[model samples]
Target: MRLIKAARALAGASQDELAQEAGVSRQIVIRVEAADETVTVDAVEKVRAALERRSVVFIPSTAERGPGVALSKTG
Candidate 1:
């Protein structure tokens, strides 16, 4: 989805880099980013974790920020 691709960009990671960091295949990253089909939660979590480590934050929808991803301020 857009969120995944944004997070990858925020992390300065290519699909191959994200896949390696998440212990998944580059195709998985591509499929996820494209939202072409359903992917497992575990796969999403792995990709999320990889981005989080690189200072990407997944913001839940709220009264303020809304739902999205961003570069962590602390980073």
Candidate 2:
């Protein structure tokens, strides 16, 4: 998803770094970011969690705006 790439960029992390953080392979991150339908929900969730752990907050899309990411202000 766009948010994944954005989050990674915001975190200043490489795919390898994110994969290590998520406990998944770099290929998994690539697949998920590519929006490959075959990628499992679990893999996607792991990637999301990894980003969250780095303070990347995922904002859900609303009628007025599309989904987005933000860095958390908290510790």
C-alpha lDDT score of every prediction, in listed order: 0.90, 0.93
| Best-matching candidate per TM-score | 2
The parts of candidate 1 lying over 4 Å away from their true place are 63-66
What is the per-residue lDDT of model 2 for residues 25-45, given as tens digits with 9 covering 90 to 100? 999999988889999999999
Cα displacement (Å) at residue 43, model 2: 0.2
TM-score of each: 0.86, 0.96
lDDT of 1 by residue, 1-75 (tens): 899998998899999999999999999899889886688878888988999999998988988765898898898
Candidate 2: worst 10 consecutive residues by lDDT? 66-75
Model 1 residue 6 lDDT? 89
